[model samples]
Target: TPTQAGHATIFPTGTSPGTSSVVNFAPGQTVANSAILRPGAGGQVTVHLETPMAAGTAHFLIDVSGWISTSGYEPRGARVETIEPVRIYDSDLSGGNLTGARKVSLQIRGAVSTDGGAAVVPPLDDVVGVIVNLTGVNAYGGSRPTHISLVPDDFDPNVPAQQPTTSNLNLVPGQTRANLAIVPVGDDGRIHLFTLQGETRAVVDVTGYLVRREDDTRGGRVIPLITPFRAFDTRLSDFHAQPLGPARAEPWSFEAFVNDVKVDGEPVGKQAGLLGNFTAVDLERPITWYSPVRTHMTIYPHPGGGGEDENCGAPPNISNVNLGEAEAVPNMALLRYGSSGMGPNRLCVFNLAGYVDYLLDVYAVVLTD
Candidate 1:
């Protein structure tokens, strides 16, 4: 569907994983990136079509439910159940109308007496995967089916566009978008939302769950931080550079949470998962050049200074990567490390709109576990 409107950017062609982009396609609009890739070989992905769909014939799909081996990457213990946005499934309140290819089964182990009591996920047998906020509201169609592929149907059936979990990026025809997925549930625990066409009306907001330890023989690992290490560059810091502006009375968008952050002296802890890249810069009224709305940037877990947002532990970890008007557009952020007591793992970034300045960079860090 690319004879006119253009846009597409999937990654991993070869040595270009500064925190992979993973998915993007707008013409019919649909883009996704929940940041999960373990590719050392077989899972190879690469797509890049910003404009050429002239004759257009691109239909690729790849779905897998499990894989990890950081020397058997054993990280068993992360029990968070912060609810609030709960609605397991509602294909029009259970009538059924998904269109082309469809599959839905978000049970998540006795979810508190089946989503009525609420909260109690993946605890059936020490589960291992869940952190969602996947929403795709008004998405009827006219040939619209940008993206949607939450994994774990046991295996088989993949249209990740490249590696998506939530993408309605350019969604039209009603429009309602939400993206944030870390799917991996089927051992009968359930979680497999698919979509090849467009019928839309999907909303599953669980918010947290990832536990695996019945004597975990150390077996989960996907360390793919593939080269990218900058960490912070407010134009090289002196006292917040000269970029981010607009909040004359405070509203333009701003919130930073870099915390301690040190190296040869002390401080620098919090590992289990993280593949970073969050670059935003308004600098001089540059919002739409090549096209990019929603400015971008919202990396959570620094609710320490809360006014209230509950630290946003669930649908957190956004930045499918976009924002290039003034230049410095790099978004690929991801997370997975809330287990010791479930508090300070450090990281909170929210820019949201016009006016920006942030250059975080941490290409990889799964240090063990």
Candidate 2:
């Protein structure tokens, strides 16, 4: 401790991401400082004052990195944690008895990251509304906040300050819960949704809350909804290449399967895999079959794209292939096809291998379109 070393207050509520604000101490004191870090909190950030010690004025700047966790008491570097911008008053530091502890909040302007590109500032004037709530009252004191305000990011003390406007925001206070809602304006002049919950303030509470609510297992089985869309463009024109000898090519066929299905039955569909320039209608007519030859068939790891995987399967050449006349054009939207049966369809398998689980990541039928 220096000759004039005094007590310092630590903000349990760290700043938000994409913004920067400063914290100051005795104006001219060269205080030797070390900040404790708590993971997920603003990671061990401290500003060393360089000037001579001022009797009772000192401050430091804080930057809100958007990726920071919005939890209560989120340990920053070692033992540090950040407070929510709106919940700072409820923070433990807010009630501490430090003699000269005071912080000034400010909105960041063009706040840029070292590695990230140029920063994009949110529209402050376009903020039209806000609402908030809290839950899990437990044994804590009764909730108290009735209203809230958001100061301008460019507010200056040197100039006369204007009244900070308030929006028609709702503050629902419940015996066991609290809630907030804000209609933040976007660059496109549209209102976006913003909400905050008190349960997500700290790590332990959040883990317990999520496990009790989302991970509850009481029913026999549950299945999430699947989007009715194709993952990749497996149409003819998409795979069409240079012309081949006219030997009356044969049509290609594909089969798909699903296992360990419980509730929503497996996916069903007649998906048109890979085809040269021929459409589904062309399969109506057939011609002489030519001798099958081995060719390179690259199966992408993902529907849209992916890197090559050597362990997937050996490139197998499909023979006795057939070609038909061009029918209907392929739809860019329905790049791949799926149907009830005998197609890009869904299949179900009730019993699965014990202690074994398999997830179908990607399955492609490559053809020379």
Candidate 3:
């Protein structure tokens, strides 16, 4: 039992003096979030725990879904390329609701853009995986819980793919919720989605994709950590025990080292981007007449110099997390770090409205080396 809010951070073992990944848990709430991470040369990682209350006031559990690696036959390595998020599938616009155990296939290769003429993604042969935001709307499971599952279309290409025991987004009745998922792309360049225990309208927006690197100098390769690591929690005293006020932006530097030693060969200061899970917790409701207050947060590369003017301008229309009052919403983010001269290796988080505390758990780092 937690007396107060707490958090945990996981990172490559020996990497100290850095706060890149983090997850927060509040009293009476058990939250589970996941991220990809790159391990140290020793093939191990470290977990750090903290709380505003007593030490050991919080408990944690870790799980590994799977892993990825490259074979010698491949030319160059696999790298991540992010783009403006674009909607690829929406049940409401296409046909109808997705019922229990029914799967829908969406083309990842050469599909028509859905975000009013956003650029299309590369062909299937160039892509190995895709990062998408999955949302569930108006879900009803009657007496059972409802969940959504996503997988490559080739899981069983000949017929409707079976619903896996796992789930990406779990929804409540009459409520809309969203989650992030990274699914592999099959040779057919399509993916399949299904609902379990109820029917719901589904929406998928692609944020980025993993592709075979055409050149080593362009994109960054993803390095999965041994496990998800919590690197920052606003509730912790050492991390500033305060909630982010409405319409405020904060800059965070990206620093990672192994064994308290900085290696020249590692991507340390050369990080191209990071793949982290961002959560909004303890949301302060607005004083409006709206039944459920809604807000959003956006993250972008920090323009360097660190002056007073180093704040996010209008905040792009894109959002990393769409949050509701009193709801702890978590979303995966694939954010590029600032390049040379422009706040190198840093990012800025901007809160659109309402006050909220943040938790960041890192699962992977994209290296440009």
TM-scores, one per candidate: 0.29, 0.17, 0.69
Whole-model lDDT values for every prediction: 0.48, 0.22, 0.66
Once all C-alphas are superposed, what RMSD does model 2 give against the true structure?
Answer: 27.4
Q: What would the per-residue lDDT of candidate 1 be over residues 161-256, giving only the tens digit for each residue?
A: 434354323344555555656666777888777766656666565545566654533222234443444555666555366454432111111112
Worst 10 residues of 2 by lDDT: 202-211
Range of the 10 consecutive residues with the lowest summed lDDT in candidate 1: 248-257
TM-score of 3: 0.69
Return the candidate ranking by TM-score, descending. 3, 1, 2
Model 3 misplaced regions, further than 4 Å? 1-32, 38-77, 111-113, 138-144, 154-161, 214-218, 224-242, 245-269, 287-294, 301-319, 322-327, 338-346
Top lDDT prediction, candidate number = 3
Ranking by lDDT: 3, 1, 2
Flag the better candidate by lDDT, 2 or 3: 3
Per-residue lDDT of 37 in model 3: 59
How many residue pairs clash per model?
2, 80, 20
User: Model 2 over residues 1-369: C-alpha lDDT tens digits?
Assistant: 123323342322343221111111222332211122223245443333222453443443232311222233322211111111121122223232111111223222222222335532223332222211111121223333222223223233224243223321112232112212222222333321111222111000000000011222221111211211122222335334212222222111234222221234544232223211111112221233643221111111111112332122221111111112321111100012223223332211111111111111121221111
User: How much is the lDDT of residue 39 in candidate 1?
Assistant: 55
Global CA lDDT computed for model 2: 0.22
